[model samples]
Target chain A: EFDQIHNYFSLNPLYRASEMRKDTAGLQAAKNNMSTKFVLFSDQKPFLLRSEEPSRKYKFAVFNINQLGTELLERGTVIFLGLETWDPDSNAWFAVDIKEELSDIGPKFFPEGKYATPFPVTMQMEPTQAGIFAEAHSVLCWLDKYKFCSTCGSATKIAEGGYKRVCQNWECSSNKGVQNTCYPRVDPSLIMLVVSPDKKDCLLGRQKRFPPKMYSCLAGFMEPGECLEDTCRREVEEESGIKVGRVDYHSSQPWPFPAVLMLGCIAYARTSALKVDTSELEEARWFSRAEVAQMLAGQHPHGLYVPPGEAIAHQLIKSWVASSFSNL
Target chain B: EFDQIHNYFSLNPLYRASEMRKDTAGLQAAKNNMSTKFVLFSDQKPFLLRSEEPSRKYKFAVFNINQLGTELLERGTVIFLGLETWDPDSNAWFAVDIKEELSDIGPKFFPEGKYATPFPVTMQMEPTQAGIFAEAHSVLCWLDKYKFCSTCGSATKIAEGGYKRVCQNWECSSNKGVQNTCYPRVDPSLIMLVVSPDKKDCLLGRQKRFPPKMYSCLAGFMEPGECLEDTCRREVEEESGIKVGRVDYHSSQPWPFPAVLMLGCIAYARTSALKVDTSELEEARWFSRAEVAQMLAGQHPHGLYVPPGEAIAHQLIKSWVASSFSNL
Candidate 1:
C-alpha cells in the first residue's frame, strides 16, 4: 500500500537501457533512426504544445532528428532518454539542450511552440510526460553546470552516452580510479510529517518563499555520514525545535529542481514545544487533525492550505490523516 | 525496533551546531579554546593510538590547538566538526587535513602515533570513535577533491566552516544564487536482499572485487529521477536478471568511504532466473535459508561466509533469518 504513492513526475515510462550506454555504435544507430523522438530544452525551460480540446493541458513538443538541423544536432548536448519499448524497432527517445541554438533555430522549427519554466509546465503535463521532463531537466542542468572537472579544474568530455563525463587531463584524480565525481549528482533530502506524542496534531512549517497561507512538511538536504532517519530528526529539530522519536518511511519523489530525491517519512515527535528557528522558517506550528483536514480540502477558515496534490508533502499529510495516525 | 540497527560508523555523537557555522568570531573562539580536540588526517589516513593492556583496541589520537602548533594549523585545511555537548563550556571538535604539514610536524607532535587507512583502523576502534572518523574522513576527502568550483574552472575558498566552498570568481554562476554544488555531496545508493516469490530462498551476488566464497546483497547508486524502490528493482534485475516486486524499506546506513548514504531494502523477486550480468557481477545465485544460516555461523561445508556484524549486509541477512521471511 505504501508503494502505491506515486507522486507527479514519478512514473517514468522510458526503459533506461543503462547497459547500452557504452555502445557508441548502438547509440549512433539509434540517433540516426527516423523513429527517434527528441525533447528540446532551452535554458532548462521545456518546450510544450498547448492543448485546449477537453481542458487546458500541455504536451511535450517532440521533434525528429531531421527536423533539427545538423549543426544544432551536433553542437547541442544530446542525452539518450531511453527506448519507448525494449524491442529493436522501438522508438528511441532523447533530450537535447538547445539553449545556444535556440535563437537561431527556434522560429524555423517550432514557430508555434511555447517554452515555459519546468515547474509550471510540468504541473500541466501528464504524469508520464512530467516524469520524462524531470529526468531530462536534471541531466541537462547537470551538464551545463559541470563543463569543467572539480578535481583538477580541467575541461571534460561527455562519455557513456551522456550518462558520464571524463576529465580531459590525464593527471586528474577522477581518472585515476572508479570515481563517481563525473556522474550526474542527485542530492537526497528528507521531507517529514511530524505527529505529536498524543497524535492529536501534526507539525508543519512555512518558509519565507512559500505562499502566504500555505505550509508544508519540513525538508532539508542530508549531509555526509548521516542516515535518512538522522536527517529527518535533525531537520525537524533545527527548523521547528520538535524532537522526533520513531521515523517510518512512507514513499519517495524525484524533485528535479536540479536533481533531488525527496524521502518522505512519518516521524513521531517526543516533544511538543514550538521554538521556530527564525533563520529557517517564517512560522511553524502544530495543526489539529480537523484543521489539517480543512486545509487539505481547501476549507480552512483562514484560506490556509497544504502543498498541492502532486507534492510528496501533500501525500504525507493525507496518509497521516487517512491512517488516523495509527500503524505508521 | 528497525531504528535500533546502529551499524558501524553510523552513531555520531557530536552536536552539529549548524547555525553557528556562519559566525566567524564564534568559530574562531571555539578553535582557539584549549579544550577543543583535533583529529588529524594525512592523505585520508587517520592517526590512532594503540591500547595493548587488555584486548587490543584502537583510539583516535586527538590533540589540542597548542600541541598542533600554529604553523601546522595555519597551513592545513581545518574543519569544525561539532561540539561534545550543547553547554557553553563544552568541548569543541575539529578535523584537519595535515597532508602538507604531516611530514614537518609528524615527528614532533605524534612520533608514537600510528597511521592507517580508514577501513582497517575503523574496524578496530569503538563505535563512537569510528562514527567520528566516518564524519571526518568523508568531509576531508570531499574538501581535497573539490579544490576548484564545478560551475566554473576557478579556484574556490572554503566557507561555512568546511561545510561549503565558494567560487572566487565573482562572475561564476554559483555566486549568483543558492546552489548545492558548494556543499558536501552524499550520494544515495540502494542495497537490497531479494527474497524468492515462494519465500524459500534469498538472492545474493558477488563481484570480482569481493573475496572468494562471499556473496552479499545487490546494490547500485540511485540515478536521477529514480526513487529508492525503483533503484532497488532496477539494480536487482540488471545485476541478476531477477525481476523484483513489492519492495519494503528496512534501514539505512552511512558508509563514508567517500560519502554515501546506503538505503537498505528487502525486495521480493517476481521471477527466479539465474542470468548474471558478468560486467556487474561475477556470479549470482539463490541461497536456501539453511545455507545462509550455515554461512552466517561460519559452518558452511564449502567454507562460505557472510560479512561481519558491523556491515549492514550482515544485519539484513540476520533480520531476514530472524523473521522467517514472514512480515518483511
Candidate 2:
C-alpha cells in the first residue's frame, strides 16, 4: 500500500483558492488588513531575520505593508499568494520583488544594521515563509523572464493585480483569447523510485552538481502530449536503461528552484539491466532496503546518504524503508 | 482495481526522448531523413488534409520538410518533437508555427484550392495525428506567447533547437542556471470522479460553457505548494461543497488545449451535500450508477452525455461504470 507522508515544500495550509478572479479587490483588502504581512525577494532570495528563539535560529523577515513606504511599492511587482488560515485571523501575505529597484536605489529601505538580511530561499525558512516564498519567487521569475509579448515582441503590462501580463500592443494576436498573453506558467516533472522485480532493492542516481555521496530518485519534466506515468517510465529507461512496469503514484512536492511540480512515484521494474547514461547521471545503482534505511537514519557505514528531509527524495526513501521493514 | 486503460491522448507511441540534447544536429539529420514529416499549426489550430481511405475521413496535413520553401522556414518557429518509434521507419515529426507569417505571406506555399484546410484542433483528427497535433499546437502556442523576455522586456531568441527561449540581453540573471528561459511548460490539473460512500452514485458538475445537460468530473489546476490529492479534494469542496476522503490517481492525459497535463483520479466522498459555486459551475449533483452507465453508452433518457472517448472525463466515467456494475 502507498503511504502519504509529509514532503518538504508540499505542506502549506496558508494557500487558498486557484483562480482569484477578484485579485484586484483581494490585493487592496489584503494591503489594508491589520494583520497583513509583506515578504520581500531580491535576485530570487528571500530576506531573513535572526530569531531570538534558540530552537530555531532563523525567521522570515516579514514586514507590515505600510513599513516599506510608497517608493518601494510603486517600483516592484506585487503578488498576492493567499490568506494564512493557520492563524485564526486568516491574514493575507504578499511577496514583493525589488531586484531591479535594489540596484538603482541601493537598499535604501533595507538600510545597514537592519533587523533583516537577504538570504537564499533554499536555506530553511519557517514552513509558511517557505511556501510563500516559493509562490512569490515563481511569479517573480516568470514576470522577469516574460516582459515582452510573444505574438508581436511588444512590451507587456501587469494585469489582474499581478496575476497576469497583457501585451501593450492592441493589435497583438496574443490578445485574441480569454487566455491571451498573460498566463502564468508552472512546469510539471515526474520523480520516481524504481524497484527491482523482486522488490528487494530500489534504484537511485546522483548528478555531478549534487553534494558528495547524495543519491536521489530520477526526475524529468513532463513533456507536451504525454501523461505523467509515461514521463516517469521514459525517464527511468533513459537515465538507467531500466524498463519500469506497474507504476504507482506516491506523492507530489512543489520544488521552487524556479518552480516545478514534482510528482513522486514507485515503479516495479520489468528489466534489471543497469546501463547508466552518463549524459543524464554520474552514477546509478540498486540499493537494498536495509541500506536505504541506514542512509535515512544517518547510520550508513560507507558515508553515503540521501537528500535532507526538505526534499521529496528523502520522503520517498523514508517511506520505502518504513513499508519494507515495519513488520520486523 | 484500477485497470490501466489506453487513454487517447496518452497513447502516442511516437514520442521518443524527453530532453533532446543534440536537438540542433538531430533536427538537421531528421530533415535530411527520407522519413521526415512536418505538422503545421496556425493560431493553435491544426491544418487537416482529406484521407483517401473511405474508413477514415480526415488526416493530418503532413508536409515533407524539404517541400516547404526557405521563406516559411525563415519566418516561423520549428519545434523538433521526438521520433515516431511506433513506425518501423522511425519518422521524425516537427510542429511548425506559421501564425505571424501566414497572413502577410498569404499561404504562399500552402497553395489555394489545395487538399488541406485549417481546423480547430478540438475536432477529431486521426488518433496518432491528433496526438501529434496536440503536441505541435502546444509548442507553437508557447512560442507565440513567449517571444519576449519577462525579466527585462527584451526580445528573446529560440535556443536549444527550438525547445527554449533565451533572452538576448547577455547579462540577464535568468541565464545563470543550466536551464534558463527555454523550458517548455505543462500546467498540472486534477480531475476526479467523486463516488458516494455506498458506491450507489457519483458526483458530476458542469461549467457554463459545457453543452446543455453535459456534466463531467470536477477539475482545477494544482496550485503552488500543493500535492495532487489535496488539489483534487480542494477543487471538489470548492465547486460542489462536497468533502472527499480517499483519493486515488486513475490515469493522466495530455490536454493540449494550449498545454495542460490532466491527472485523472477517483475520490471516495465523506459528505453527500452538494452546494454548487455559481462562479465555478452551473450545477452539480449525484447520479445513480445506472444513469452514468447509460450516459457513457449514449443511452441516457434525458439526452445527457459525457464527453467523447478522447477526453479523460469519458475515461473516468467508463472506468467507474466497468468497476461498479460490470458483474451485474
The regions of model 2 sitting more than 4 angstroms off are A1-4, A15-26, A50-57, A69-71, A86-89, A99-123, A324-328, B1-3, B15-23, B42-44, B50-57, B65-76, B86-90, B97-123, B197-199, B324-328
True-structure Cα RMSD, model 2: 4.4
Model 2: per-residue lDDT, tens digit, B264-290? 999888889788899979888899888
lDDT of 1 by residue, B248-290 (tens): 8888988888998999889989899778999989888999888
Query: Which numbered prediction scores highest in DockQ against the true structure?
Result: 1
lDDT of candidates 1 onward, in order: 0.85, 0.73
User: Clashing residue pairs, candidate 1?
Assistant: none
Fnat for each predicted structure, in order: 0.73, 0.64
- Please tell me which predicted candidate would have the highest TM-score against the true structure: 1
After superposition, the stretches of candidate 1 with alpha carbons farther than 4 Å from their true spots are A1-3, A52-56, A103-110, A326-328, B1-3, B51-56, B100-110, B326-328
